[model samples]
Target: MNTLNLADGYKVDHRNQYPEGTELVYSNWTPRKSRIPGVDKVTFFGLQYFIKKYLQEDFDRNFFNKPKQEVVAEYRRRINAYLGPDAITFEHVEALHDLGYLPVEIKALPEGTRVPLRTAMFTIKNTLPQFFWVTNFLETILSCVIWMPCTSATISLEYRKILNQYAIETGGDMEFVPFQGHDFSFRGMAGLEAAMMSGAGHLLNFTGTDTIPAIDFLEEYYNADATKEMIGASVPATEHSVMCMGTELDEIETFKRLINETYPTGIVSIVSDTWDFWKVITEYVPQLKEQILVRDGKVVIRPDSGDPIKIICGDPEAEVGTPEYKGAVECLYETFGGTISETGYKLLDQHIGLIYGDSITLERCQQICENLKQKGFASTNVVFGIGSFTYQYVTRDTFGFAMKATYGEVNGQGREIFKDPKTDDGTKKSARGLLGIYKDANGNLEMKDRADYETEAGGELKTVYKDGQLLVEMSLAEIRDLQAQEVAMDLTQEESI
Candidate 1:
């Protein structure tokens, strides 16, 4: 595909629409507001991936490395067909191709930093005077590529915080927290690329994921080595089809074969709601209890279709002593009993566990943990499969993300520009002039708008990409460590409150 075509249709004619003497355009990407409750910050991520994949590799492969005439003619052909033959000329395209590099500088907060609302997470400007339009010309693709990872990472951090609080409260193993929130979002994502990006974002806070390609993406772009370190991992697991193939009447046989013949060892997750979730939990599981307990590892039961909170923590309205009333955790406790935590919460036997993945949200997650604590069970007894319901049901506006040019220069004169629409709420009002981000005395990141050149050049933002080359690189390990530190700090603050 022609990399130039990977933009909004209206952006094609933008090169000629700028003022006659426009020499430089300085723009910043900021999250103006957050619509998510209790989430006042956004996670800064995917900037490095954008620079490496789109800015450097894509341009070099499809435009700069190709023959100038071929790419130029292709660009002209597409524009002519879309907007008539004389809609725009191809001079700028040919000139950029001849220049052999994208002339833009991108300075960004460190990947994995939790940037506060209204702060500029990154700033972009043209390096050369003639390529000022390139600053915002790249906006369409940059916004498309960057938003999902940031959104997913932010949402993932929320999940992490919830799990961490419950784990500490319930005396659960803190190391198990990373494996508690597994990414089951790949199959339900928009496409392969979206899955990889969102899945990689989820991996920032968790080590358990079913998104295999996400590991490949991190390795290729973020300097991750699967052999040397754990990127993302999943245990042997089964779906509805596997159980159905073994025949419903002989579901017990399927369990026997799996626990006795197939795996007989490490952790294995089997989807239990294929036929009768209650029967599997109350009857089939008890019939196989001896086998399950005798095995060398844990047997994780997955309930895929139900109200996740009620299903895992018991349906309160049901009969008092029934399987549906007791839920998966209590039902398992009846068969394979385990010890209690230091905090007095019931710890499920090491040989059995439960995971619920259907349509999970942060609210539901918190509710489940709250209910479990009330029922004397540790919150760690159930692992959560964070599927598309949490990762895909979001947009760029989830954090009110936008990229607007605040400062520009024309004919050697600097201009500080902004917009405050009277009809709309103040959320759309953008910052004026150059922007810089700094930490105040409270140690919270804050943005300073209308700053002079020197102030804009300093503070938390670092130059990650410049003139078509990557200036700073962060490995997956480094990003994960940084995110862990932020999460720890957040947990500390929450406790005080």
Candidate 2:
């Protein structure tokens, strides 16, 4: 497919729709509102990835690097067939191919910054007057590629906050927080690309992920090295099929083999609910207690079904003195006694732990942590497999994300453009004219729209890409450090409050 065809059908005709002598189209990408409660800000991420992958690599490979005539002919054939013969001229396509580079400038906030709702995260405009249509022409791809990573990163940050709060309150090791919220979302995502994007978003906040290609993506685009740093990691773990292969009757022997023979000196996870989950917890675990204790590593019990809160933290509605009532954490505690933390929370025995990955949510994660704390256990006693339910079940509207032209120039006269629909709520309302982003005295980001070009060029919204070249690139470590600073500031504010 021609890279130029990677847009809505209507976009091909948009070049001629602009007013006569229109020489510039300045647009900004903003999140108008947040549907997720307590997440008033969206994490700014993935712009460098988009610029590198699509604007530079894809265009060079699929469009610019090819013979000008070949690429132009391909674009013409596609457009004519899609929109009927000669719906639009191929002059712009030829012009772009002849230029051999994207003539646009993009300015953005630092990638890891948390941008408040209604504030623009980035702005784009054509650097060449004759190529003004290029800015919004790229809008379709920009919005499509950007929103998911931002949404996933924002949601992942919320999970980080929740887990961090619980870890502090429950006397858990702070170093273990990154490994607590593991990503199990790869298979559930929209496709391979979507999984990689959202999984990398998850990796921005956590180190444990089952999405293997997400690590590859970071190494490729974000300057991360798995050998030199902990980009993302996972332990040897079993699913239902691996357990079912041993048969439900021989499940105990399977656990014993995995612990003693398969993974003897490191963390191993086994799904415990292929048959009767409670029986495995109450009967099978105790029977193999000595084997587990004498082993040199942790055996993580994974319960994949039932109410996650109840499965890991006990059910108030179940019968007393049963495994269902005691829950996986308490049952493991009974089989292998553990110590209490300095803050008086129970730390599970080193040999055994628990993880629940099925349909987990932020509210459920909080409830599980709270229930465990109430039961006198550390929040770190169990890990969470954050799957597609959290990352896949979202859309661009998850944060009301949009890219709209706010300013334009026609006949050398600048126009302040905006839209506020009288027929509906203000989520569709857009910022007017050129925009500037600045930090307040308290270090919170604030927006100033309708500004002049000089003002828009100032503030924290620095130039990241210009004229087909990346101006500023952030490494994975730098992004993580920025996020940590933001999280620390947020926690400090919360403490003061």
Candidate 3:
């Protein structure tokens, strides 16, 4: 059930077989931009777990456990088939593995910090005297480990910002903002690791997730044991399969059973749109009002299809009674007759609520919240299910993330390496020499190039990975605290603006 089981299987076999005499390949990776104008920072996360799980455990268990001769023979067989004959040597790999540890060091900005664009988040250095190619050799695995969690964390943080803004404006309970944007991306992720990593990223901002693997990942890697602290949770909710099992004609009966028979207490969600969504909301809901009202829990009606903004906030121009009828949130408000909050926004009745789970984007989320605010309704009446479109629909290039060697040593000499392609614009230019990150006086992130790692003093960048051992550890609670601090900083900046 480990997320790295498959990737660890074959990743040790992937290595470049050229450019002999390479004694070192030092690299530093950064998010140059977020592919959005005026967006200049990313939440740094999950690198330590990557290093521990894949670099240490996976390689040690799969590749290092093999006999040296057998490992060398396999590498030769595989590499020679691709490159002529004797393109490279596996002696260094065997030697390092035989030494029982990875001769590499990774210095990184503390996980959960809001790292600035074009600033180096991590610097990779090969500590082995002769194995200069080791650091670059691990680029395949390192890049794979770095990008997704950071991207997902950044995206989830953006969602948190939007929800927090609306909560502040509409007088919704600020504490509820953490659960306002739930993670519904498990079934939509690329694979198990993608689901767990991205889901863990979502947990950086919220406490609501349906991704089971994420909880395990947090407990295994981030010190978030469910028995100790609140990592993430979700209410008992029905999918289309469960609703369809009762057949469309008996859909109302299915709802009745879900409320009365299966879960009569706490919170429960039923996919109301399995047959006729509006009919369930406008007709059957009122008919079952007695049962729903008397129950000790809230019934969250889910609308899975149609334009989310219009479906949740009501269509201004569309005719009533049509399939594109007035949305679920507005309908719930009409039937329940809610009280107004101190901010003059309508708060739905405690017994009923709404959640939209289909094709939700950050832009659409803003529109839905704004529409509700304009209609005198608090954003708390509804929750948004952030899925793959917000998590998996991204790549390393989404933030221009790349790991390039900037400093290296060869033949008793120290070299500062860099690349600035003449064929392209300045976006490809990379940093030179050793790098370090520090927080400025105003609590903003700043970067600096150092003569060497030893010369750096009291910087925010810490030694996270060294000699196949993890040096720093973070917990889910600590990460949430950092995010809360970032939110406070953002609020302060907005006030200044």
Tell me the lDDT of candidate 1. 0.92
Q: What's the true lDDT of residue 279 in model 2?
A: 91
TM-score of 2: 0.99
Cα deviation of 303 in candidate 1 (Å)?
1.1
Task: Itemize residue pairs with steric clashes in candidate 2.
Answer: none
For model 3, state the Cα shift of residue 460 in Å: 1.9
Tens-digit lDDT track for model 1 on 78-151? 88999999888888898899899999999888899999888899999999999888999899999999999999
Write the residue-wise lDDT of candidate 3 on 410-457 in tens digits.
665667888899997778888887776777788777887745666443
What tens-digit string does per-residue lDDT give for candidate 2 at 210-264? 9999999999999999999999999999988999899988999999899989998
Identify the runs in model 3 with alpha carbons over 4 angstroms from their true place.
Answer: 1-24, 320-325, 450-458
- Shift in Å, residue 19, candidate 2: 0.5
Quote each prediction's TM-score: 0.99, 0.99, 0.93
Model 3 / residue 466 / CA error / Å:
1.3
Q: TM-score for model 3?
A: 0.93
Candidate 1: list runs displaced more than 4 Å: none
The C-alpha lDDT values of all candidates are: 0.92, 0.92, 0.82
What is the RMSD, in Å, between candidate 2 and the native fold over all Cα? 0.9
Models, CA RMSD each: 0.9, 0.9, 3.0
